[model samples]
Target: MRWSAAALAAGQILVGGPVAAAPTVVIIALLAVVGLGVAVADRRLNTAVAWRQVSAVLMAVDLLATLGLVLAGLLQGNDELWVLLVLVVLAAALRYRIRGALAVALGAGLANGLLELLVNGGEPGPVIVGRLLVLLVVGGFAGSIARELDVERRLYQRMAEASQDIVAKRDEDAILGALARHVKDALDGSRATVHRYTLAGWEEVQLPDVLSVGSADGGPPLLTDEEGGVSATLHRLTWQQGSGRQPNRLTLPIRLPERPAEYVVAVEVTGPRPSALAEGALLALAESSAVSLATRDLIRHQEASNRRLERLEALRTRFVATVAHDLRSPLTTVKGVARILRGRREQVAPEQVDAMLASVERQANRLNRLADDLLDAARLDSDALELKLTDVAIDDILRSVVDDAGDEVELLGTPGLVVEADGPRLERVVWNLVTNALKYGRPPVHLCAETDGDQLTISVRDHGRGLGPEQVENLFQDFAGSGDPDSVGLGLAIVWELVEAHGGRVEYRPADPGADFVISIPRERTPGGSDR
Candidate 1:
């Protein structure tokens, strides 16, 4: 406004050059100085009261300056400075509505009228009255336009605020409740609800009242009735009572078509029905809420999947490192012994040759066992493993495995116990348990077997430090238990699978000084013998 006013003042001076009115130049300069000062002050303070007062004072100064120019006979017809009066009225209209515009119009018109009257010795005339009327008409029209624009601005602001609130909540419950309340407040409804259909039934969330009644017993069936078309889904329903009571209900679908689950936002209005504009705003809010919920669920699922992948990747890395180390140690030993025999065969004694050959054989066996474990894991993945089933003596397999392990293993319980299983798989399971005990446990590993009810119980107890905190349930997960580089951690996993295939279960019994692993297989009946 200041810049435009300055341009008008410059134009007035250019047109009045021959007339060289010093008084007109002085008035225009004063107007510019006051306007600029007030504008700068308002920017610095930025207070409502200060700007209002400044606006009023600025309008007054423009009015007085225009009147002085007219009285001096310098601002002639179509002088361009006349346009400054209209600008002042328009600026006031936007800020202060009709009343502000009227004030500007009256101040300018009355100043002109009084100056004319003073020149005419206080006589009323049609020219003064006609100009005043024109000013009033212009003020009224501009004010009306500003009022309409203010309404649209407010409506959009309200919607924007509600959207910001929805985004700020992290959890599902807060989002639903906030969306419901915003809709109710926007449409001037008495109560609002957000209903969702789950496996159990419909759940309703509302302000001041939250309920989760089943679909069968819930009072209103509007949500469960399954509205078909778009209009049926997002339309209004009216309920009337005998006592001249009526209420308006609005429903909008939260999700789009072909959704796995159904959701609706319902509102109840006790007063006049909402206008079409209000309904549109409410529907937009519901659609936004639906998209938000879908996005939140997607992010959560992705995070869970990423965590699982990270865990598997860590396990895979550990498995590779362990296998490489286990294989390399035996290979290194075998390579050293073979080099000794090949290079120094003539000088080495006969007895030393035998000892070196035995060492090579033991290391080769270790490498072979490692290879077998990897092969078993690959077969397990492809489901190509089959068991050779037969009736086996459990006590015989356990005793034989303990003896072959070459450790101070104590065998407890009677012999001659039999069960239905693959002999080689059962023996392998016992060998795995015994190897684990010898590697990780202290001395005095105990192997026990007994008949219990309809099953035979075989247990291996190791008198060593029990399992670590991370080694409990994950002991059977592939490459999961011990942190030892020599142990590939696949023995226990294979043992678990073979036992489960034989209709048996493997369990860990916690003990004070060590850990006990128990395997129970259903007792087998012989041709001429009763159930064991």
Candidate 2:
């Protein structure tokens, strides 16, 4: 705008015969030189205030140049130079849309009319009015087109920046939040929110209903009930709660991998409807956001797999250390006790010989338990473990396991309780729980059995402090679940697998200042021989 307006007057003065109007031509030449210099030297103003000031100065330069050319044309009796008035109107229009253009048009018309009226006063009023009308139309039409072009350019630029922000995050929540904020700001909206759609809708899932779906037959399907768009809502654009005025809804359908239902983001506004450019910018942002969401899923999955691998490696290292120490220590004790009995049978007292034998028996039992755990774990891994379900007295199993744990244990059994379960496998489950409590916990272990509706539950609790939350999380994994030196690395894992085979689940309970483990199975669920 600045250079072109200036150059036109400068070019005409140089090429055309312009010596007739000396002062007016000099003014035109000076304005041309100044406008060209300013255009070349200027930088883009950063603030709104600076832009407005620069805009005013440039508009002033254009207006003066146009006026100078008009006056020069009049003084020289040349009709062609005044045609530059349209450039003045267009410059204003590009700077400040429609109204600015109209104002400049009025100024151009006045200059032409007044110049003609003074220079040739007998010129008809009708011709002057017609010239003014034509100038006004030119200003309006040109301004409108330029304004539309600037709007489109700004919209696309903002969308590109917004897309970058929305996808920069590597997590799901952050991506959703960025997309909502960009949409809200783009539409000049009051609020925006993410809406997720399932068979059950809205607040139950912690979002506002922006759109609702009912079966065309008025059934309950949400996503499939769509005419062309998904059923969901967010912000004030609620479909179910119609108030005094209807709010507009813009839904972005985001499909997360492996999720059962459709995910949606919605935008709402209490203001005027968004312009076409804003809507286009918004849709482009949504497309970018969907791709970012998929990327987030991939990134998170990769991170989880990495953590799992690290955990497995750590557990493997720990399991190796435990097996060496635990198996080797017991074997050494058994060998030493046997050597003592054989080497000094006569020298050792009868009581000393009996004590040595008892010591050997205890070490043998320790080695047997460790071997049993490894064997059970291997059977579980290969899915070769079987359950032989039969009617068994729950009280008897509880009593037997508690007795095996010695005098430090107590049984609080419901005497009449019975369950259809694999009697030996159920006993093994109880034995492992009792032994785990004793190894990792204090004395006075409590064993109890109770009927819970159609299920039977056995609970073993110890007086020692409970396990930490982190320990509880990996409590069923091979090698990772053991916290004690002699959890044997596979004791609890075997318990979990054996219980699961009986259609049961093992759970950890947080007793006050103690650790409690519970095993529960449906008493009526009798599947046998590994077939079911």
Candidate 3:
């Protein structure tokens, strides 16, 4: 019945006589008040003592109230009625498990029976006796059912909690250990082992042994021929009997899904056969545990792969640095010889001199540029490029870069754009951009700069075919140039690296007739701590 004040008042009026009803009413009212108070105080009852003690006190008070009703001759002394009291006592006993509930049941039964006999002047009628017997039977049956249900509920709760714990764990060993213990506990076995099959052979994992169960000494030999590779099977095995030894035999081989019979589970048990439900539950848990284990293993492998890739990249950067260093001296010597030959061109045969000097200078300059590019790439890859910070007019840097290009490309931009950054690196960035525009793009490449608030943006727009989405996505990556093989792919990568070193970023877009590269740098206050 739904519990409320009205229900309690009605129940008291029906069971208790008019003379005794007032006290009962007052007690019920007090209990209702106390219950509400307890509910309010529950938030503070975080400690175990409060939970256990408060509940015990409440149950005791309820039992005592029932006893008082019997004493006052207010309650009917029918068997069915008494049986209901016993059931209540049982429920209270189960929840609180206090010694008082037992006393209440026994004492109330004897006292109420005696009171009924005294008031009625003798033994009650057959109807009353039958009601008493029915009460006893019903109470006992209800109590038994409640106990069994509680056990089942607890078991299900434990399984759910265990599954949650397993899923939350990332460590492979801990997950396996917990899974093995869960299997062993559920199956009532001394041990449970998990064997994983590989390309070479079956590898036995001593999961149960790790959980401190059976001796890791010996077990049924797991071979490739075992049930044709770990299919679903159960086998009974008897240990070799020795002197002074009892026959230590047990049922083995509970196969999990996705694993071959080669993945054997040897459960040590004293019984002849495990229950059907237990066997099924054990197999299911094992299968799920295996999947979790496999997922964790894959994650571990991926982490290892990432570590190796990082190491390889570091080695490549070092190799590039070393090669650039080695080539610098030879390149310098070759350039020096070319310059000397060019100086002496007039003294030599006119035709051969011009051509020879020109060829020599061109090859030497190409070699020098290759060496510089390699060195720059290495520095960029290792993040070792240092910037010399300064406050410089953006127009000056643009003019310098354009002049260095020697009329190879046209430049267009506002004359007075200013920014606070590493002047040399910024110049290099602009030079690389303009050179790239001339080398890969059609003529009349345009340069522009703009400023807003605390940021300045410079753009180089080319008058050639625009880049596709794929090229734009990978434009800043090393060796990611498009078009002819004659073009070295490190120019834009260097530009991106230098700009980033200055705390700036580079972006690419389709210029109406070609491609546009834009660099945006934050305009910080000068080192004197004053905003520009």
Candidate 4:
């Protein structure tokens, strides 16, 4: 009912005589009438059909209103009436469907030309016709351009929606498959496949293939010939009528670090040539996918490493338990024999007693050293070695180690050398080095100490056969030895561990005739000390 009233009002005003009312009032009346009709019709029609019909009717109404106003002004001898016609035409072209609106504009233009002839009392001239033609052309062109813009906008919206769907999928295979399908649709390709290359080779995956299979067989060549290079190549191929072969093919290589060539992707397509924009977008997608594949591979490798480390830890626990159990029996026997020998020392025969006591002492010392090394290694592995730090003279510690070993070490120029260290551990380090020199060095082992600024240096020189470069490289490594049948190979390893704990470093150099092992530690300030 309201629409009927509005339409009647608009029709009455359009047919009414000329007056001084504003031109805008006429435009608003026409728009209200057209908009009301459209709203009513839309309730009974499908949305697309309703929009088209309403747009057509509104454009016609706008054209008739423009003609009526133009005719009224011409009849009244108004010269500025063409401006009203232009506004109506532009508004109609902008607001309505292109095809029907352009048709209405043509009809209105013809009516206006005829009205002009009638008002001027003759047929219209070429000047009037040309003016009408220009208006029609401008309006039609604007409408067509707007329609084309609308079509492009809709297409972009659809592509965006499809891309969003692909990105939201959790499964990689599904995502890749969707991406390939989107590419095929966008490029109008007959078929599209994504191939990944790894160190082993390349593999073809279905649109959604996510199982990570490798391509080792003579599959089609990679897009780029250069090793580890990523690029895209397009080729045109012959296709038989019913052979289901694609006529145009495109291959793209996806590269990521530390991944096999098979994991990289080569997108294959067969159809008409793809545009540069389409190809660029496809390459971008492939590169992103390659990064994701590389990330997944790294995660897998780290998980494997963690599992291996757990297994190694278990084995180490078992080995330590076994070693501890084996050493207990020997320790018990040595302790028992030592006690017996000590209690009957006066009553025992000299030769028999001497031999028995020597055997007991040797075995006891061996057991003690083995136990100490095992504990120390365990502490190091667990990162549980704590240091009791103190300032001690390096020369004093060396002298004490030599005294404990009961070996004569030839002293070179003595230097007052003090170092910040744990006394017991430092003593152990010096003793191990001196003992190693005594055991392996030719007679007359040399012990020397010197200090320079913040560093204290100590060296044990031996005249034994020198170690080779390879042996020296691994000399301080645990369980590494001089290849001697009688040596257990733990002395230098222990020396290294203890010296490192005291913030010192050790090096072995082949002396002129034998070997020289040197240790350097940070020197501490000595209080009330004289050169010794």
Candidate 5:
């Protein structure tokens, strides 16, 4: 506004010759200086509180200047001075659009027409009427264009704000919902719905339907129903904007950069077809939402990885403590017994010495059992456990584990039960189960085995505190124990893994007073074995 006004002022001064009207030149210069100073102040302060007031005051100045120009031109007989008035009207149209055009147009038109009649005391000529008409036409035309520019400016501002809002969000679903909400706000829509692309097709994600949940697959394939990829998707969006067919539902595809297309953010508009700008906003929102999703997905994966690391750390800590505690008891017994026998050999009786040696043997066996379990568990964890199957007598394996049926423990099974099996591993399984029964259960422990056709079934039963219905589902999973601090919980876990390796399975039965663990393996004999 200032620059144009200054140029016009310079031209008028030159046309009328320098010093034609010093007062008029000073007034135009003062207006430019004042306008430029106020505009710069407003920008620096970053405030528009007094903008309306300042605009009104400036319009008032414009009017006063126009009347002054009219009088100055008449007095100097310089008719080109009217151009300054035309510049003011044109400036108003570009600046204030609607109201600016109206005020400046009214002011300039009246100054040319009515002021001429009052000053010259007669009818205004064709020049005055023509200037008035021109000002009005320019004002009306530029005002409409200015209004459109303002609308576009405000729309772009809103899109930017919405983009900022979703960028700060952490969850992918929340990001989609926020974008959908803003897109719905831009249009006349009730509520926006976010859909996750799935193999089953577009599935609603918000307040998710768990029973019929959607997974990330080909998101809203309707976009890519045609041959092309992104082009077809965009073409579909354009069609929806103008396609009277699916006017009620508008879907926009959201995709990650340098990756496959992801999900869709959709809005259901109740009113007429959305304007092009509204659709453009939705498209912008889709892009912003896609970026938010990618960011959130990265953060989510990082969090999951951190949690897994933490769990692994805890597991290692627990495992080390358990191993130390479990082996210490047997080691202490073995060491104490050996020391007593060595130091008091002459004082001890023959039977007492034999008993002490047997006790030492039992403790040594317990230590060895723990060591085997630890090694087996490590092998199972690494997926390296293997079986050495042979034609072996099952009855011999079970009987060898416990020849003397003590008062509390009993072994019951068929005689000469033979099958293709790993004899030592089979013995280890029986020993672990029996030891577990003695340590954990209120025995009356029974280790039973039978053969039904070609399938051999072996069961260990005891009356004890057993698992409840809701206790644990993954009973065979490692570390799933009864929380007994003295016992390492890998007994049952190793039992299950070892059984599975033998083409067999282990099952637990919830009895009334205790629990029963049953193992079943193939009962086939080795083809080339002697029938001894």
Candidate 6:
């Protein structure tokens, strides 16, 4: 429009004659120069504020320049300069829609006709009337086309923005949130919400008002279908609340392949409802959002898989190093003790020989425990460790595991406390706890248990330095634990897996003097295989 307006004026200037007023020619040339300069200088005018300002300025310039040329009598023999008025009208329409264009058209036509008549000494001729009619008609037609084009432009721009937002979000919640915000803005609504139908109820992006599904108000439900499978539909809602606002609703059901109409986007506004262009945009947004959300899910799943693989690789490397060091230390001790015993049987006294043998036995026991933990871990990894779900006394498991820790370990719990579990697996869980307490803890390690309703609570507490916050956090992770010399790091991991298999959880309970490891197993749940 800017170039066209400038070209029409330049054509008048080039058709040289006295009728082509030199001042008029200079003004048109100046308008073109200024238009070209603005176009070149304001390259970053992508925002609404900048574009609107530029359009207003250009429209004003075109109208004033056209009037100046007509007043100067430069266009007396030619009405070609009138084409510049059409461009001015179109520019007004682009800036402020059809009303703006019609305004410019009427104002320019009357101003030009009045000026021409005054210049020609009050002649009400056919030429002036015809020009006014041409101006009004051209302005009205151009305004209509501009309005339609503007609507289509806005729709495309909004859709593209929504699509970009969807693709940029990395998670489902973010995608849904982005979709809701963009949908609301696109539809020019007060509130917009995305709802996903679930078995429990309808879950929405924004917490719905009291009018959500299943409320006692018994107002019109959000979902039209009784089975919660409605397709795309729009409805008008009457609210009992609000002071002066009349709220309307636009519901669009987004259906994915092989899925029912489970996800819906609802937009509510106070004033006017969305136009057909906005409705079309909403539908396109829904369809594109579904595909983009699915693609986002696939991307997230792949990222999670990659993270798991990286973790497994790290665990394998750490496990190999830790197992080798634990096993080698114990075996080397046993070997050194045996060599000493073989060489000094005659020189050593019976008491001294017995002490040496006990040292060898302790190292051998350490090696055996390491081997057992490794085997249990491998069984857990292979999903081959089945549980023997039977009625077992929880108190018995606690006392037995504590007693196996020797005299220093104390048992404190209720009697005849029973639960349904794999006795051996439950015993290994207790055994690992006791082993951990004995190895890293002070004397008087306490094992306690209690049955409360349907849950069995067992705790093995250590009165030593216990563990730091960091150690406590990773206490139950593979190859991760407190930096105790005797810890192979698999004891608590195995204990956690076994307890979880029995439908229980183990946690590091904060104790005043030390740290407490508590395992809570539900007695009502049937035992299952371990998960490490």
Top TM-score hit = 5
What local lDDT does model 2 show for residue 43? Answer: 59
Candidate 2 structure, TM-score to reference: 0.66
Query: RMSD (Cα, Å) of candidate 1?
Result: 8.7
What's the lDDT for candidate 3?
Answer: 0.60
Question: For model 2, how does the per-residue alpha-carbon lDDT over 92-120 read when each residue is reduced to its tens digit?
Answer: 78778888889888988887888887766
Please report, in order, the local distance difference test score of every candidate based on alpha carbons.
0.69, 0.69, 0.60, 0.61, 0.70, 0.70
Better of 3 and 6 by lDDT: 6
Q: Decide which is better by TM-score, 1 or 3.
A: 1
lDDT tens digits by residue: candidate 6, 1-532: 5566456555556664566657567666668766775776478677878777776776677788767665654345554455566767767776677788788988888877787667656775887678778877877787888887787787779788888877777776676667766776675656666677778866654544412433344343444334455333322221222234334656776656455656677666555655666666766776677787778778888999999899778667776777788788878878887888889788889998887787777677566666766787899899887666788987777766654467778888887888888887788788888877777777678888887677889888878776777877778887675765444478888988888878789998766666788889987764443433
Query: Residue by residue across 1-532, what tens digits does model 4's lDDT show?
Result: 2233334335435655445234435655776787777777767666887677776676678666566556556656653455455555566666664664465556656777787888777757885677678667766887787675665555456456655666456566765666666655655554456665445554455543322223234344334332444344222211222224323445544443333334333333444554454455555555555555555567788989998788567556655564565477567767777787779777878898767766666555546655676677778778787777778876677766555455567766466766677776777676677767877778578888887568778888888887788888889976566776444456688788777766678998889888898988777634632211
User: How would you encode candidate 3's per-residue C-alpha lDDT over 215-243 as one tens digit per residue?
Assistant: 56654532222234432243322122212
Residue 250 miss distance in model 5 (angstroms)? 3.7
As a whole number from 0 to 100, the lDDT of residue 382 in candidate 4 is: 80
lDDT, residue 207, candidate 3: 56
Clash pairs for candidate 3: 79-131, 79-132, 229-261, 230-260, 230-261, 230-262, 231-261
Task: Note each model's CA RMSD in angstroms.
Answer: 8.7, 7.5, 21.5, 16.0, 6.1, 8.5
TM-score of predicted model 1? 0.59
> With candidate 1 superimposed using the best TM-score fit, by how many Å does residue 105's alpha carbon deviate from the native?
16
Q: Where does candidate 1 stray beyond 4 Å?
A: 1-155, 188-194, 204-253, 256-273, 305-313, 332-366, 379-400, 422-424, 468-473, 482-489, 523-532
Considering only N, C-alpha and C atoms within 3 Å, which residue pairs clash in candidate 2?
209-233, 210-233, 210-234, 211-232, 211-233
Ranking by TM-score: 5, 2, 1, 6, 3, 4
Candidate 3 regions exceeding 4 Å error are 1-20, 26-54, 67-87, 93-108, 125-174, 198-203, 206-208, 215-217, 221-266, 269-295, 298-302, 305-309, 312-316, 319-334, 345-532
